[model samples]
Target chain A: MALKVIDTIYIEEEIKEHPRTIDISSKFKDARVLTIGKFGELFNKKSQSFRLQKRNPALILAKKAGRCVLPAPKGFGIGGHKNYYFSHMYNCLYDCSYCFLQGLYASADYVVFVNYEDFLEEIIEKSEENPSSVKTFFSGYDCDSLAFDKITGFAQYFLPRLRKIENCEFELRTKSINIEVLKSMEPIKNCIIAFSLSPDEVAKTLDKKAPNIKRRLDAMKNLTDQGWNVGLRFDPLIYSEDWDIMYSKLFDKCFEIIDNNMIHSVSFGPLRFPKAMYKKIKIDSPREKLFIGPFEMNNGTVAYKNDLEKQMSDFCQDQLSRKIGKEKIFHCVSDVV
Target chain B: MEYSYSIRFVVALEAEAEPIIEDYGLKRIHEINLFKVYRNNLANYWLIVSGIGSINAATASIFLYQYSNANKSSFWFNIGIAGYFTGPAGEIFLVDKILDEVTCQTHFPRSALTKKIKRDELLTVSKPREPLSTSHLIDMEGFSFFDVVNRFAVRELITVLKVVSDFPSYGYTKITKNIARNLISNILPDLREFVAEAEEISHKELIRLRNPASYNEVISKTEFTQTQSKILEKLVRDWEEVFPERYLIKEIDGLKKSSEILRKLSSDLNNFRIDWL
Candidate 1:
């Protein structure tokens, strides 16, 4: 899906004159520009409904003050020993029904941290601190890495700088088909363009305002065909009556065009959320039918029943084992679980 | 059970409220002396004429909310006149940013209606001021009206609309009660259109809050704890969403205890297979 036109923008007082902010502000000339002391003054305010704000979200441009990079949550990475994630942006352009951002954030406005240099500086420092091991730096945990690239210029600014970090591997996870910036640049060996995918039926029903599975698959093929290593993420495997057939067809379609050798890693996991977050999401989208599935609370986490989860996981694992090696496949469990 | 959609308009003057009350055919309720309240019982439209200042607007809004029995889904609108730095006088604007001159705090009201109406920034001062050279639209109650109503409802459900009554060129002295009435009267069609769009949005929320027909049937037949009642309400809602063609009451007719009814409903929903196609 293409990015929609933004109608409003809130700029932080400190970053009002920042070059990146000015560059972004230039793109949306017709949008109403409002100044504020901090992004949180509006973004974190109470009584702001994420559901309502999602309809017409504003963009907040601010500066990331400190700790631009942090360690990734447990059970959240591919295979790197040291996995860290950085968020230069908060909130995604797409509004998937199962997205945790709806619950994690009070408002649905997009917050772009214009301080790209601070994040790069911290990433380089962390990578240098762990020179002996391959530290995987994951982007798009809190937001899509490339979905808002045209507005934020995140990939254009960060990719070349990250390419120089030899000891670190950077993963840009996204469901977006916006890859023109990546296509223009020379392929970096350490950068893996990971595309999150689900069955066509599941995605059509649950992934609102996102690119369809076909478009994502085509983007993946286009990227990998250009010698860029790609990662396949079937995480949050949705469960339905025909889930087996649906996922099998999805896997077959993915492997048909792209060779298994071009894949850097493949990860899949059951749909799950922390108990508190699950409740929040349920409250946020009370009429959503997806929450009516066979889920149970275990160890303070809400997910498919243990037996059902095991059955689905094993079936996918067995299916994936036929195409990819076991070493390259990872099972992502919820950190709370 | 049926859920009615509601919208409350908080105008600062009786003259400002006159056109809206007449347009919606609202009758004045005699009980409330704190503020002048008017309502259309059949349409669920309400209006309160708050006197003047920031405190009066906030207090009158709360009073109307309680007196009218407004719910979380109800839309609250602070609509009235304001003075803009440069205005031809009948131009109306939906407020996007509200700056309180006393506290210097800013508030942003979230509304999809901005796309339908022209928007501007509003400065809520402690008292009326001479038109400044700045671009802010001046008002006396916008900030407090927004701050207080926001606590009771989501930002999207709360809005502040201002019509230019006076400007630097046409000062405040020329504006009389008749002019105020005429300004609002001339813009009644646009105001009605805005309220209609707001009501359309509020109707969707009301549907979300509406209970299934079987909910009242089941609750009337059995006694349940407050916690169990909430659970049953959710189950009933899920049942209606998933199996709208089927009657939940028919499935739980013989169940006496709330626990039994809850278990039965859960088991049926869990066992039901959903076809994505």
Candidate 2:
């Protein structure tokens, strides 16, 4: 089994004398050289025809400033209205079995677009279109916002611009220990640093290269100490044997570093995946026991039986509500907000 | 001298690769990833079952190349289990070439590749988990060796060999993990000689890569935390300034943004309490 790095060709016109792209070459030292084909051809290749292209992942760096189609940030919420989300990078450095990006993309290599100015311009224009005054932009939907904090300076370039906008808010959702990025920058009131958590046992088995829950919590503590807004996300909650204790302890840990008054919002959801996508992932790694179970299919999605899902969600909601008020807790689901 | 080489066996899985080294009395030069390297008296070598994916293979190849760096000439026989396209559960293959099948890039060159091995037109997919396909042979790490050794111009350095354990139809389930574990243990001696012969090379133009001096300047210019600064301090000390200064700087910038984004998102949500009905 080789490093299986396909190939990456340089595109000079995209970014001018960018230093970050040069750094990517060194991280993958001695990686083989492959053709640099067009963007649509390389990233969107799922069929067998383009297999010969040797699609080595590339890191693109550009400036993104503003845009159109800015989701109404205040009136609508994430399962409720237009929430504008953007991915500066596609694919992650870590390989997790349940990740959707694996089935969604053709190549395993990561392609980072080095354009930050362009993204900013679009966000600025969209935010101005609505007079609601409060616009929220979501990062980490396609990729973990902080996982590669060492590779791309996303938060650094985007945060200053967001702070200048009167009714704009930004979310940095991640499972990374690299919070030092925040400590060095100017503290803006409109930003919320969200941490994704699971039980230690579950993370050890599934999170792959992600920093353990403890490390992430510690990072959150450091950020909160510096007067930053923090939130907890227990997403895609994988069911384990000792359900009650696993979640209770996870909550206890979060409330330790976070001020009860400063906690922004908390959300939880059950483990689920698209049926066809799940099947493809199962074929990619057949030995994974997590996928081979009595999963219930609900609304073209697979999850625990309805009763089990209700039980897990209810238990988490009830117990978590005791520590923090019910008002700060929200369940992120497509069906209801 | 024109050399005639035949690939004797290709055993997949690190567990299987280890016992074979013991059974064949091969010289254990390096233990990288999962595979333990062994060689014969003639200097013929075998890179035994290393591990289960491209990352494992690449790491093992780097270790192997470093171990053999001082030798006169060293060749490798990438012998292990692989998934195949043809029939017969136990058919043997001389995989003259290793392809990334997905990227379709032959990252390595033909001269550096194991010879007399047929270019079976098969693919080696790397998985961090278990092999989900019903292909020919499924081992953890192989293509990485094909990739690294070639770029290093050490291709004149090896051979590729594989043995089919389960046909494509069996769904890779029939071969129990235990049965598949012992495949390499059964074929150690033959693989060692094939590698020993390929290690021969005459020294003429040994290409050495050049270093850029700008790295040191970046390190000195950027501001880093005590912990961040400490990491940079150690890295610079160990490798005489080829360390990635720019990567460290960008990391510093990223950490700054992450904290800023979180702070902004949180404060915006504060004081907004909507009771669920």
Candidate 3:
């Protein structure tokens, strides 16, 4: 998808002089720049519509204060004893129907924390705190890691710093094909550039403004061919009458271009959400057909029925195991009843 | 005659409202005495004259909203004349930010309209004021107009548009009723285009809020508790999404209980196979 033009930029008074802020603002010379005391003053304000703001969203540059790194939720890692995640950005460029960011944030504008050193410092401190264990730090929890890289220069700055850290694995989860910076440099063995995947039909229908599945698959192939460790993520597996056939074809297409040995790991997660979040997203997007699917409240969480969940998980696990080892395939089952 | 409008305009004076009223061919509604209200016979637009100042603008907007029975999906616009720091007295601007001089509060109106029109920050003062060190467009009703209308509608559907009437070189006393009318008259074409876009957005929102025709038919034929009514509403929406070609009313025609009707609808939706191809 073509990048939407940035017509307005809100700068926090604290970060107005920051180098990153200046660099980003200089690119959009014509965009109107407004000063504010804090990003939350505008981003967290009520009466803002996520749907409407998605049409013409502004960029808010701010200095991230307080704790920059937090422990990852349980069952959200790739076999690491200590897992953590950091968000240098809030909100995504793509408007996926099932994205949790829409319900988590009231405004659809992008918030880029200009202070990247603080996040890196905390990651190093945490990794050094437990030097013996393989601590994994996940990026792109709240936003796509590389989708805004052209403007944010996220990977170009963070990859070099993260490469020097000892016994730390970094994961950049994305559905973007913005890989020019990644292709220019040597692949970091410790970093895994994970791409979120869905069936072509499903991605086309649900992942609005995101790169098509074909483009994503091609990016992964190119990165893996250049010796970059890439991972496959089939998350929030959308269910339909012919889901099995569609997913089977998807796996065949993925394995056709990407070598099995180059694949770092494969993870599949069932479509699920906290009950309150599901309710909010449903209200925000009342016409979205994905919300009207076969989902039920299970122990304060909304997910597919037990039988349906099992059928999907078992089918995906069985299909993926045929090509990759069982040890490399992880089932991301949340702590829901 | 009762007419439903999706776009409501709140102007501070009749001179500012006349150009729009004439351009849209709006007829005055005699029943609404609290505010001077005009609406087109096509039932898509309304304009109200709130006699000058922030409080009057707020109260008149509320009055027009209730009197017109506007829905949450409707668009609200505050259009009038304002003083700018350096203006030729005919420039139009879409207010992106409103700073209230008295309250020291600021509001950011979501501007989803096209960027072809120039945008400016507005300062809503308590009374008439001259240009200050800042380059903000000065007005008397923008802040309160946004502050109140936002409570009734989403910020995206709310806008504040201003046409510069006086600036540093031209004093406020030089402005007259005819000048204000002409200033607005000159921009009627652009204003009409902007309203058309807003109307299209409101129309889509209305469609999203509307349920399938079968929902009303089923509700009229059956007896349901309040909770059952909500559940049946969701079930029918799901039925429409899953099986648009199928007729839901015929399947639940003879079903008396809400439970039976809901079950039939749910079963039909569940059993239907969705072809992704």
Considering every candidate listed, which one attains the maximal DockQ? 1
Q: After superposition, how far is residue B52 of candidate 3 from its true place, in Å?
A: 1.2
lDDT for each residue of candidate 3 in A125-194, tens digit (9 for 90 to 100): 9998959998989998899999999999999999988889859999999999999999999999999999
Per-residue lDDT tens digits for candidate 3, residues B1-277, read 3222399999998999999999889999998677889988876688899998989988998888888778877898899888998978899999988999999999888856674778889999998977665689999999999999888898999988999889888878888999999999998888988888888878777776766658889988778889988888888887888777788887777898878998888887667665655
Question: Which of 2 and 3 is ahead in DockQ?
Answer: 3
**Per-model lDDT:** 0.88, 0.56, 0.88
Better of 2 and 3 by TM-score: 3
Docking class of 1: medium
lDDT tens digits by residue: candidate 1, B1-277: 2345789999999999999999999999898777789998674898999999999999999998888888878998898989999878888898999999999988988875644667889999997777777888899999999999998888899888899999988887788999999999988889888888788878877776676558889887789999999988888887888888887778888889999999988997888766777
lDDT of 1 by residue, A1-337 (tens): 6567888999999999999999999998888898988887889678878878888889999999879999988888899989999999999989888888887888999999999999999999999894899899999899999999998899999999889998899999999999899999999999999999999988998889899999999999999988889999998888888889999999899999788889999999778888888888877777788888788998888888899999999999999998889998999875632
Badly placed stretches (over 4 Å) of model 1 are B1-3
Ranking by TM-score: 1, 3, 2
Off by over 4 Å in 3: A335-337, B1-5
Chain B TM-score per candidate, please: 0.96, 0.52, 0.96
